[model samples]
Target chain A: MGSVVMHNVVSVDGFIADADDEVGPLFEWYGNGDVEIGAGCTVSKTSAAYVQPMWADLGVLVIGRHLFDLTNGWEGSPPAGEHVVVVSHRPRPEGWHPEASYFFVDDVARAVAKAGELAGDRTVGVAAGDVGGQALALGLVDEVAMDVVPVVFGSGKRYFGPVDSQHLLEDPHVVVQGDRVLHLRYKVRR
Target chain B: MGSVVMHNVVSVDGFIADADDEVGPLFEWYGNGDVEIGAGCTVSKTSAAYVQPMWADLGVLVIGRHLFDLTNGWEGSPPAGEHVVVVSHRPRPEGWHPEASYFFVDDVARAVAKAGELAGDRTVGVAAGDVGGQALALGLVDEVAMDVVPVVFGSGKRYFGPVDSQHLLEDPHVVVQGDRVLHLRYKVRR
Candidate 1:
C-alpha cells in the first residue's frame, strides 16, 4: 500500500489567522516558487515548469471540509490517481467529482482506511485543520513533511492539531535551499 | 507623543510554528513579498529605498525580549528622536547604543512611558509582544499594524502575554494587497 501522508505549509507560533477565514499571502508565483499570495502581485522563485510536475504525483487528496471548500470544489481530481476525500459531517454535493471521483468520511480511521484502500499503489494525503493530528492520533499517517516559513503569526487558529510526546516520532530529514523556507520530512517512530 | 503600531506576518491559524517549529515550504523565495520577515536568502523588503526615509521619522522602538534577542541586538537605538526600549526584567548589555540609546525596563508601562517621552515628534513603532501587550492593556499603545501570512503554525509562543479584555482596541483598518498580505492597523479604543 502507498503511504498516507499529511502535508502543508506552516508558520512559527501556532495560530493561522487573527480572525475569520483569512488565508494570508501563500504563493505569489504559480509556475515558479515566486508566486504571489495576497492581492494581485506576481512573484516567482520556483517556476511552474519545476512545480507543475509535482502536482502530477499527488495520488489521493484527503482534506477537512474547510480546505475542500477553500478550493471552491475539488473538480478534476488530478491525473495519475488524484482521488479527493473530505473529513466532515456535511453531505457531499451532487456530482462533486466526475470521472476520477472523491470521497468524504467523517471518521478518522475510516477515512484513512478508505484512502489507503483507494490509494491502491499511490499516496494518500490530507489537508486542513486538525486532520493531520487526527490521522497521527489514529496511527494512520506514515510520513510528515512541512515547509517552515520564518514569519511569526501571533494569534488566530492554531495548526499543531495534536502533537504530544506520546507519538515519539523520529527520523527527521531536512531540505534547505532558501532562508525563508525549510522543508522537513519525518516518519512516525512506531 | 508617538504612535504605537504593530506589524507582523502571521499564519492563517495564528501560530509562528508547528509543535517543533515546522513552517512548511511557504517561504522558499524569501523576497517574494514587498514585506519580508526574518533571516533568509533575501534582502529585507520593507527596508527598501522608499522606506529609508521613514526610519528617520521613527521615534521609539518597542520590542519584547524574544524579538530583541532574535535580531541579535537592537538596531543601535532609533535615529534621533528615538529610544530602543527592550522590555525585560533583567538588564541589557552595555555599549548596545552609542549614547544613552537603549533602555531595559521591568515594567511595560515604564518602558512605554519613557519611550513616549523620548519620542518627541515621531511615532513609536513597536515590535510588540507579551509585555508590549501589557502596555496596550494599560492603555499606552495607540495603534497596531500587522502583516498576516498565509500558512498555519499550529503551535508556539504567542504574541501577547495574556488578556481578560479591558474593552480596548479599535477596529482594524485592514488592507488586502495582491501579495496575499493583509496590512491590518488597529487603534487603542477607549
Candidate 2:
C-alpha cells in the first residue's frame, strides 16, 4: 500500500507566498542543479542521486485547480509522469483528457481516493497548499516535508489556512539544503 | 557605540508561545546542562563556555512591561546583570528601585536611547516580543537571532507584530542544535 505526502517550501514566518504572490526568494535554494540537501546538513551532491529517486516513487499527485492553472496543466506532462487529480468546483478546462493522466474532481476526499486508485503501488504526492492542508486536517495525509527558507515576508498566505483541530507529528527527518535552507520531514500522527 | 539585537525561540508556525501562554516544549532544548549556542548552531558545551560570555558583553537590555511582570523583573538580576530598561505607559510598580539597574520608561525610543547610554561600549539586547517587533518596525534593530523548534503550534503571538514597513534581512547564520533545534541568526539591513 502507498501513502499520501505533502511538501512545500515556506518562509521563516510560515508564509508560502508574499502579498505580491512571489515565491522566488523562498525557493531560491531549489531548481538549481548544484545544491544538495540531505543527512541533516546542506552539502554538495547530485540531485539525481538523492532527489530524483523520491520523485520516481510518486505515482500520482493531488493538487488544487489554482495550481493546475498556474502551470498550464503542467504542460500535459506532470512531474515524474505521475497522474494528477485537480480538485475544483468549476468544470474541467476545455480539451482536457483522462488519457493524459489528468482528472478534475469536485472535493478533496474523492481526489485523494482517486489518486490512491490511480497510484497502484506507489505513493500519492499532494502538491496544492489548500488541498494538502485540507488533507492534513482530515487526517488523510501520512507525511509532510517542508523546506523552510530563512526569510520573513511580514505577511502572506499561510500554508495551513485554518485547521480547527490539532494533529501531532512524530520526530522528523531533518536536513539542511544549500547554505541555509532547512529541510524537514515528519510523519503525521493519526 | 552599541548594537540592538532581538532573540527568541519560535515554532515552525512562528509562534513564540502556545495559546495557554506556556513556552514549555518550545524551550525543551534549552535549560539542559550540555547545550551551547553560537553563530547559529547549538553545540554541546557548558553555559559558561558558550552563553554566559555573550551575556557578559551585553551592557543593557530593553524589554516590555508585560515581560517585566511575567518574570518579576527577571528576578532582580537581568541576564549578565545588564542594565534593564522596561518600556511601558503605566506608572512604575511600587517599590521599584534604580539600584537594581532597572528603569521604567513610557516610550520605545527613550528606552533604546537609555539602553544605549547605559550600554556604552557593549551591545544592548531587546528582550520583549512587542518591543522587539516595534524596534524592527522603526528600523532600530540591528540583528535577529531565533532558536527554531521543530513543533508547530497552530497559533500564538508572532515575534514580529504589525510592522509599519518592510525590513530586508541578509543571509542568515544557521545551525542544528541538540538534534531537532535550529539556531538562526540574521543581520538587519538598514
TM-score winner: 2
- Candidate 1 per-residue C-alpha lDDT over A25-69 given as tens digits, one digit per residue, 9 for 90 to 100: 322122234554222323244422322343445577777777677
lDDT for each residue of candidate 2 in A21-100, tens digit (9 for 90 to 100):
67857765554445444322233354334455667788998988888888878676886536888899986778765458
> Could you tell me the TM-score of candidate 1?
0.50
True contacts preserved, each candidate? Answer: 0.08, 0.23
Clashes of each: 66, 0
- The alpha-carbon root-mean-square deviation between model 2 and the true structure, to one decimal in Å, is 4.8
Candidate 1 yields a Cα-based lDDT of 0.55
C-alpha RMSD (angstroms) for model 1 = 11.1
Worst 10 contiguous positions by lDDT, candidate 2 chain A:
A39-48
Candidate 2, residue A2: how far the Cα is off, in Å: 3.7
Among residues 3 or more apart in sequence or in different chains, the pairs in candidate 2 whose N, CA or C atoms overlap within 3 Å are none
Residue A105 Cα positional deviation in candidate 2, in Å, after optimal superposition: 3.1
Output the worst ten-in-a-row residue range by lDDT, candidate 1 chain A.
A23-32
